[model samples]
Target: MALGLALPAAAQNVDGVVRPAWAPSGLPDRVVLSPGADAARQMAVAWRTDARQADAVAEIVEAIDGPAFESRARTVDGLSTDGVVRGGHGRYHTVRFTDLKPGAGYLYRVKGADGWSEWLSFRTAADEAAPFRILYFGDTQNSILSKGARTIRAGLMRTSPDVVVHAGDLTGRSHDWEWGEWTAAGGYGYAMVPQIPAAGNHEYSDDDDGRRRLGPLWAAQFALPENGAEGVVETSYYTDYQGVRFIVLDGTAGTSLDALDAQTRWLDRTLASSTARWNIVIQHQPIYTCARPNDTEALKAAWEPIYRARNVDMVLQGHDHCYSRITDGDGKASGEARRAQGAAQGPVYVVSVAGPKMYGLNDRALTQPDRVAADTQMYQTIDVEAGRLRYRAYTVSGVLYDAVDVVRAADGTKTLREPVESLPPLRLCDGDVGPDGAPCVGSAK
Candidate 1:
């Protein structure tokens, strides 16, 4: 039988332009927007592209009138390009735009060898103490695309946060595919919101081919504050925004007790000197874990006292793929047990996860934490108002699972409130799997 076969138009091939079949099918990936010192004045951006277009440049413009606010066009400084071999070959670049006015929206584009990327837009943070929102996620290291991506996307859709905080483990490994997954999970939200990432254990590797190092992709991906400790540059640093101060610490450095000692001293000085009303500290390891053993004694012995002495508001951590809100400083339940122990004010330690990896809750988690969750994917949104902070945790499906509000009275006493909100089932597991056939193994001791 004679059949008339029609073939689709052959893919267009242009001379001198290299495009890989499996490269980022869409626009540039891992787009990040960072606020500069002036908020309204300066900002930074980073993104990844396919290897074919290694030397790519970015175009930025200020949006003015309409909802799009199309403004004048200008070119910003481009960063050095590097090769990333993931599922295939890829390239990554970063760019920084300075001298911008505070609290202004800027639209940008990336020009590659093949074509130019779409116009991505971002706004600088207001230079003054204006209300803003931030999204916090933890341990998006494994199952990034399948399970973690949806949670992150949901969080972004639910709350158009001004900035995002990664507690740690942005990728399972420092490989190209993992990085691609990380950026994909974030998607366009990364470009819209500035990212503040902490260094986790997964970000480190041992020396094998003399190429092993700590935080290789981190420095290249984000333009952070450089005012960290003397030797610990990228791993440990602090940034100030509006009325808050965020201090990040690195626990991987083991030069000696001297290293942690130096960090402790720096932390004390930073907290003591900061005039900001809110002081939040971020790190990978939790001082009080709900899934793992109590192994943060070194940090506790060194930094906890400082946090308490300085009235630090909150301490956020991730590494144990679970959720916990430890308040009252007792690290114990808020009943007779705490009264018997006679505890006082201390920093509220919260350990949470946003990815699919699940861990069974520890035995102590049952009564020790004021609120706890196990074997679940979750994210946190924290809203800071004048003398009041509201924190709410949600499941991947946008269900409000847990919530707490801390109101600081004029006398400096913080009060906690649990509003009457219907939450999902507690969903705790005793063994490796829950009734829903999901693995819930607790953290390794």
Candidate 2:
């Protein structure tokens, strides 16, 4: 999904591990906002300051039309954790604002040694199921700023999404410079829209002893909802926004950081008890893949049945660095025509890559997926309503690439209805030349 550009000093070297410079620190940097499980009642924000600013402080006030808004302001102190990132010491701060009014706009700011950060504004979700939009991005791993930033900006410019969901691998290497470019790429987008980030394999570190732990930056950078399986609380969690239930799972099934069984059990219970009209699962690795030679057989064997039995609407995934959309019985025969015959549908599995790291589509790319793309960077936008949901996919430059509409039935069932839309021609490599008239990049293996 990427074609690399000469990176700036702010980016990492070819190794993706070592980098130059300590994190810039005059004001708060890498500010991010995450929605609590009960988005209508609580919100969470995390920001990075220098190690000197050990104590964390933040304040929130109802956004007023004029400048006289200090009377009703509420200030809160939060827990701060200090750690070494890329060899330099820094402090990260997080604060959760609870007992908030649903469907209200609020302005908040964090404090540092120099002064308080710029006042940022955000709106909470409504108390009940309502119309809302969300933006989804696959791995923004390679060439984050040089290539992936444009894709993120394209999403910001095109729609008004209530939430932003990352299918994982925000960076190829969990280093400071890569994260810097990622933040600069998204810029204020991360602060404005509530983030629902899933943990990717690249985000974990396998120690010499073969124990897998989250990268130093993951847990410290974002405060996610805690409503997950008790054993895998850090990476496995779920959030309910408006009327949609977003179940996030860690897909490192057999790794040292394995949580496949706990997550499987939690997913079943979560879906069974869900009252939301729509249910969507987000994870790092794909249940079905177009880039890798085969699917994550472990994930498919464990989670696929639960997704089907629960009647989940969509399974958003990343880590393959390729694009694919596979529906049930899609590859067998009469894929699209299966709709012609009366048969119940299951969750739509999607795998996409947004960063510059590109991989060749597997042989099944042509037949298994409803649609597939290789060496292409793209983004997807989903709009949710009371009984209808619409999903649209677009290229980095903002061209509509794919889409479908879903209608909820009277019995809490849903149906994906493909809408007719024109898209650009498929991109492929001709000998050694690419569709861009440049050397064909990425892998075809």
Candidate 2 lDDT over 126-244, as tens digits, reads: 89999999899999987788788878887876776789999999977667676778777777678768999998988877779887767778877788888887677877888888899
lDDT of model 1 at residue 197? 86
In candidate 2, stretches whose alpha carbon ends up further than 4 angstroms from where it belongs are 1-22, 85-88, 253-256, 329-334
**Candidate 2: which pairs clash?**
2-356
Reference-based lDDT, residue 108, model 2 = 91
- Candidates' lDDT values, in order? 0.71, 0.80
TM-score of each: 0.85, 0.93
The sequence of per-residue lDDT tens digits that candidate 1 reaches over residues 123-215 is 776666666777889899887776777778878778778778889888776655566567766766777677788888787766677443674
lDDT minimum window of 10 residues, candidate 1: 1-10
